[model samples]
Target: MSKSDQLINISVIMSVLIFVSAWIVGLATHKLPVLTTVLNLVVGLSIFIYWLQKQIRINQHIIEGREIVVLGCELIVIACAVYSIVFKQWNGWVKGFQYIFFGIHLSALVLFLIFMLTFKMNKLM
Candidate 1:
């Protein structure tokens, strides 16, 4: 990967780790509302914006149906996060969003690792 891509990847990983850690800590202690809510929203929004930019750059053409769906998902997550922050409570809607966010991200990470492993194995063969 180029330096910029590496940097982006590192940042994404760090932010995700921080996000997870914050959630765990908040759940355990019920303290650090700023870290749990505000930081999470900021990091989540930044990640979504990064992905949106990359998607646009790659496609170059207008966003198609799939991109629109992705955008909607991002917006849903953002909206849920905002609602949770404002309400200061985790309702079913917020919990559902949290589950979906982690599920999507974790599955994508697993698929990426699988693809990279297969590519490397093919190169060795």
Candidate 2:
């Protein structure tokens, strides 16, 4: 397969793995909020590392400014989500913020998929 196809496959696999692992951890540690939060943080960091590795494979010359900005923002959101999970006391507002961050994180992933598909399609044409 082409590099783009390979990258896309890897991305999808990693995403699924992350989601499954998180769900499993949540189920296994249902009584231990701390353990669940830490495991989720590890999964989140793994995703960031995977993303960084993929970014490194791209040509630096073609990297766009907005892409970097969006990535930075996503990272911040992830960090906030982790922090809130670990530090904030469980309450209605904390739960709301967590959901908001989760939404941002998923939306960012969708945007990234769209960007990658468009880029690959443009290269083909």
Candidate 3:
């Protein structure tokens, strides 16, 4: 497969993983402590890993820049924030959800910094 295709595949898999983790965390929102902790840790780490891979595969490195993907990630985060604020009740496993959100935010910041630091784009035509 082409590099871009492979990256898309991995990105899909990671997204599914994140979704399943959120489902699990929601299920375990009020249950056994051991199970809750295990699921939370699993979800958190999966989020971190997924974002890490995306940053690498998309090559949004602060050194070897790619601005669009970074911008796109930020857009996703903005959407998520709006969804969470308008829809969510702000309790009951919100912390777990926020942990995942944090991952997304950090990922966006990495992307933003890349172009913000490296590239010198013109503002006016």
Candidate 4:
């Protein structure tokens, strides 16, 4: 890989590690939960944007169909997270919606991981 690509990968990995560690520490200490949540949301949104831009640039076309739908769901989950953080006192309905979006986010994450792994394996073979 090129130097710049290597650098970007390293930086992304390091930041993820730092965030994960901070999240774990926050949970263990029962402190900084809000801060960690905010950080996680911001990072997740940033990564999504970065990946979208990279895909567009590399493919020279807009992402469509299933990718677009998944991206929309990801955005919804981020919005729900922000809403929860901002309101901090959700009613039953709001909480239910948040839970639904959270499930969508988890499913999207797993689906993307599987796609990536399969693509890599296909490339290797």
Candidate 5:
């Protein structure tokens, strides 16, 4: 696999791990302030966008369908995050699932920083 592929894999793993962590945090915390809600929504959305960008083989492989399903899962997570953020509370498991999104965004932030250091940038025309 190429560096780009490795980066994507690492990012995906990070996303999943952070997502788990977030859920843990959410269940452990009871208060949902406005800032927390907005933060969660933003983080979830960011992860979904990143994964959607790298999931580039829907029509080319047998596993594409599974990947697509995962994509939908991510989107649902994002939706839940946004929902919690806006409403200040979720009625069910959505609450627990929203925190990990901030963790995913945190992981992505780290990877992006490493990428900036690893790759050189030039002016693109």
Candidate 6:
């Protein structure tokens, strides 16, 4: 009903849509490295844009220290994901474990970002 509630709902829907679309693209283009790379890049860029929009919307009310901490953690998570993708090579159970670890890390990062946004909103209200 409220503006913030509407924003939250929209954010949730967009997140799901992004994930599903990305998964579909990844599945469809798995055999073509170039197409897969382009699609994955598009998905990554879209998610980044969504994150940037949310950051700008909620950041005005957050304190400097909290903002820095949130950004730092986000960077770390991004770095870890990139490092895993670029540097790590594994097969079988090791690959499965790596994916599980990455999934957990990504989920935590998303939850943290949402929590930060909610905290900022609560403070503003």
What are the C-alpha RMSDs, in order, of all predicted structures? 5.3, 5.8, 13.1, 5.7, 8.5, 7.4
Where model 6 places Cα greater than 4 Å from the true spot, the runs are 31-80, 88-98, 101-125
Judge candidate 6 at residue 33 and give its lDDT: 29
Worst 10 residues of 1 by lDDT: 116-125
lDDT of 4 at 108: 50
Ranking by TM-score: 1, 4, 2, 5, 6, 3
| Model 3 per-residue lDDT tens digits across residues 40-118 | 4444455556666777887456633555565454445444444445674344564455556555544544564454445
lDDT of 2 by residue, 1-125 (tens): 47766677578657655654655675587623433344435545766787788778877646588867856755664675577665764445544554454445545566766666555552321
Cα lDDT tens digits for candidate 1, 1-125? 45554554565566556656766886688654545446546646876888767777784666679867876776776777788877876656566566567556655655654554344332221
Task: Give the TM-score of each candidate.
Answer: 0.58, 0.44, 0.29, 0.54, 0.44, 0.39
Best by TM-score: 1
lDDT against the true structure, per candidate, is 0.62, 0.57, 0.50, 0.58, 0.59, 0.50
Q: Highest lDDT, which number?
A: 1
Task: Tell me which of candidates 3 and 6 scores higher on lDDT.
Answer: 6
- Show the colliding residue pairs in model 3: none
User: What's the distance in Å from true for residue 81, model 3?
Assistant: 7.1
Give the per-residue lDDT of model 6 (tens digit) for 22-118: 5567558662222223333344455566767887888475557866675555454444444445754333443444344434544654675576456
Model 5: pairs clashing at backbone N, Cα or C within 3 Å: 22-99, 22-100
- Candidate 5's TM-score: 0.44
lDDT by residue for model 5 (1-125), tens? 45765666576567556555554665578444333455666665665677666557355534468767756766776677667656767556665465455555566666765665577555211
Candidate numbers, best lDDT first, in rank order: 1, 5, 4, 2, 6, 3
Candidate closer to the true structure by TM-score (higher is better), 1 or 3: 1
Indicate the worst ten consecutive residues by lDDT in candidate 3.
Answer: 31-40
